[model samples]
Target: MNKVELVYRELLFQALEKNNFLLTQKELSNLLSMSLSTVNLSLKPLRRMNAIKVNPMNLKTINPRKVLLYWASVRNLNKDIAYQTRVDVSISEIEKNIPANCIFGAYSAYKFRFKEVPADYSEVYVYADSLDEIKKRFPSKSGQPNLFVILKDVNMGRYGKITSLAQTFVDIWNLGEWYSSDFIKALEMRINGILE
Candidate 1:
């Protein structure tokens, strides 16, 4: 993820997920290990969109759903995929075997967040620092990749084992798979349910 995308993820994770909307640029810089200027630059578009309001000491999102939709529109999921390979195993088995550093995303993320899914999904997406490590763990290959290892950004670790709701939505929306819309519909309801 680029710095701006990272900023968006942080906003969603902190504000929407954690219910902490009082964020200062300095705090963001400190937490993200980014320069003050970069954080400022990242917030500019959000300000223009009215998704966030910039104050003297802090910034607050006015419409998180707008911010999320904006991110979904811009996110390039394919560019983030570091590695893709087929693993001959059940999806649960693949989930269980992934390295600790990897954060489950997409369908797996939905399952983690909601504890259920509308239907079964074959793919297991994860964000990891090193694709080589994942490859080593699941060495055996097959026809098509049921496993997608996305390159992890520096700031992504804060969300822990599963991708944040915003991250999961964006990733699944970008997938363009047959079942992606189903996941997106379910996720939208879940997100709305939380925000309400």
Candidate 2:
């Protein structure tokens, strides 16, 4: 992901996952290792969307749903896919065998977040730094990939093993799989529960 997307991810993680709405550009820049200009540029969209209220000292997310939806709508999920290869193993097997540094996302994230799923998922999404290692571990075939390894960013593991809720929601939404809507619905309900 680019610096702009990293900024968004950081902001979303702070607000939704960390329960922190007070954030400064300087703090974001330092945390994300991005320039202040880039962080400001990324916030412009959130400002325009009225998703956040910018104050002299800090910015606060006024409408997290708007911010979440905006990021989800614009996130280039395909571009982040560093490796895609069909694996014959079950989703559980993939989940159990993922690299230690790799973070589970999408369906795997939903399962981790909520402890259950409405339906079985066929694909496993993960963020990993070593694409070659993943490729070596899971060789590709002719069919659609059952495993998608997304390129990992430096700021990805702030929330720990699972992807942040906002990140997971956006990734699953971008998947466009038959089961995505179900996951979305479940995620929305979970988000609402949290926001309340």
Candidate 3:
């Protein structure tokens, strides 16, 4: 993920999860360890889309959905794939065997976060810096891949077992799977509920 995406993630996380839509550019720069100009560049699209109102002192997010969709539109999910292989196991078994220090993403993330799945899914995505354990467990095979390991960014900061709500939504939106739209619709409903 780029620094700009990180800014979007933090903005969405604050607006959706924390319900604190008002924040400062300097604060974002400090929290994300980026320069103030980088934060400004990231907010450009949102400002143009009328998703946020920026002042010299603080910026207020008025349309989080726009911010989310913008991030989803630009996110390159496949570029982060560090490892992928065909795990000839049930989805449950594949999820169960994911090694420690990995963050669940996409379908698995939605399931873990919501404790319900909108549709049945066939693949598992995870973010991890280390992949020796995963490579050993699910060796590369000459078949369709069911397990994808996204390379974790060093600056991706802390989160729970699953990816952040914004991250999960963007990741699912970038997926080409047949059921990804199902998850996207379900997540939109959930996010709308939260925003309401």
C-alpha lDDT score of every prediction, in listed order: 0.88, 0.88, 0.91
List clashing residue pairs in candidate 3: none
Error of 3 at 119 (Å): 0.8
Instruction: Give lDDT: candidate 3, residue 158.
Output: 68
Task: Kindly list the per-residue Cα lDDT of model 1 for residues 39-58, writing each as its tens digit.
Answer: 99988888998999999988
Model 3 residue 88 lDDT?
87
TM-score of each: 0.94, 0.96, 0.96
- Name the runs in model 1 displaced over 4 angstroms: 140-142
Model 2: which ten-residue window has the lowest total lDDT? Answer: 1-10
RMSD of 2: 1.1
Which regions in candidate 2 have their CA more than 4 angstroms from the true location? none
User: For residues 1-196, could you state the per-residue lDDT of candidate 2 as single tens digits?
Assistant: 6788787788888878888978899999999988999989999999998999999998888888988899888988998888888888888998998888899999999898789997789999999978877877888776978999888888887778889899999998898889899999999998898789
For this target, which candidate reaches the highest lDDT against the unseen true structure? 3
Clashes of each: 0, 0, 0
lDDT of 2 at 90: 84
Cα lDDT, model 3, residue 57 = 85
In model 1, state the lDDT of residue 137.
93
All-Cα superposition RMSD per candidate? 1.4, 1.1, 1.2
- Runs of candidate 3 exceeding 4 Å displacement: none
